[model samples]
Target: GPPRGRELEVARLVRQLARERIHNVVFTAADVHYAAAHYYDPTRAQFRDFEPFWEFVAGPIHAGTSAPLPMDNTFGPQVVFSKGAPPGQTLSPLAGLQFFGQLDVDSRSRTLTVQLKDASGQAIYRHTLQARRA
Candidate 1:
């Protein structure tokens, strides 16, 4: 959720979806100074690999220190909680997901449409959201 374009936005969206499902989380650990992230995978009904999506977020981590200083390698993001909610109610972690796809809304129909594509402009995901007026 740095100062990068679309990254933070996608993070926010992802966070919202997670919240809708009542999930808590940490964040992507860029260095060796952060706690691990956590999320429960509904599809598998178990814990799954948690990683932050970034420009470098998606790929390998390259650690380079000063000409004289040595550094340790990182293994990417970690998921702390895989299942079950904690006792009582608690505030949720921040969701910093911004979608990389096109989003459209129909005001009259109260419907939302999302179109997703891969890096090569191939369609990957498409979803439509509609609500009946109460």
Candidate 2:
């Protein structure tokens, strides 16, 4: 969501991926300084065709940290889980809010599980999604 030359490019790519029959699409990025989970449902949006997908964000492994940004909801994403450092608290290992994310893909089971964890490896949130049938 950072200053990309054309923001529409992101949506175009997402549409292409969906049109190509891609499933379980997920996006991850660092340096956002927070941890949160969101799900995008095409049925809930004005523009249709894109399939539902999940977005998990985790970051600030050691650098400066901040709170999770408010959801834009342009893509009809529902906030599944979200955690942020309290006001006046620095997001870091010492603050016990610094976090990371893990993604497990089981081809045999056709399942994907995402987890966000703290420095001690305790899960703050977990989500499992199964691939839809053709």
Candidate 3:
């Protein structure tokens, strides 16, 4: 679901349901090279939220996908789980991680755990936050 593309339709559907059911969805490495997306749920009468998946195939190359360190980076909010964004900027670095890892969603509690890791599957950091109601 490349934020606005028809990429990985099946995976997008699975991730979409995970968000709706309030379950924990892991950032599994699918077939996509690098993928991110903004999901618009028709049921909620508005765009629900976004879920970004990092494949780890080329994670250590981009700034958004780079390893997050306490000193060598500027940390910000997890943008992959947002509903939508400003006009013409759905694919910005602020929208999704340029690197990759896993996105965990708790539908019952509306919680999301963003786990970032290096290319070798080493844990780097996590950002947990409550999801906004639609």
Which numbered prediction scores highest in lDDT against the true structure?
2
lDDT of each: 0.32, 0.76, 0.41
| Candidate order (TM-score) | 2, 3, 1
lDDT tens readout by residue for model 2, 1-134: 32144646867887898889887678876657778888888776554557888889887787666766666545667888888876565655667677899999999999989999987899999988898876
Which candidate, 2 or 3, would have the higher lDDT against the true structure? 2
TM accuracy, model 2: 0.83
| CA error at residue 48 for candidate 2, angstroms | 3.4
Roughly what TM-score does model 3 have, to 2 decimal places? 0.29
Could you estimate the TM-score for every candidate? 0.27, 0.83, 0.29
State which candidate has the highest TM-score.
Answer: 2
Off by over 4 Å in 3: 1-58, 61-99
Candidate 2: RMSD over Cα atoms?
3.0
Once all C-alphas are superposed, what RMSD does model 1 give against the true structure?
16.7
lDDT of 3 at 39: 27
Candidate 1 wrongly placed segments (more than 4 Å): 1-99, 132-134
Error of 3 at 111 (Å): 0.8
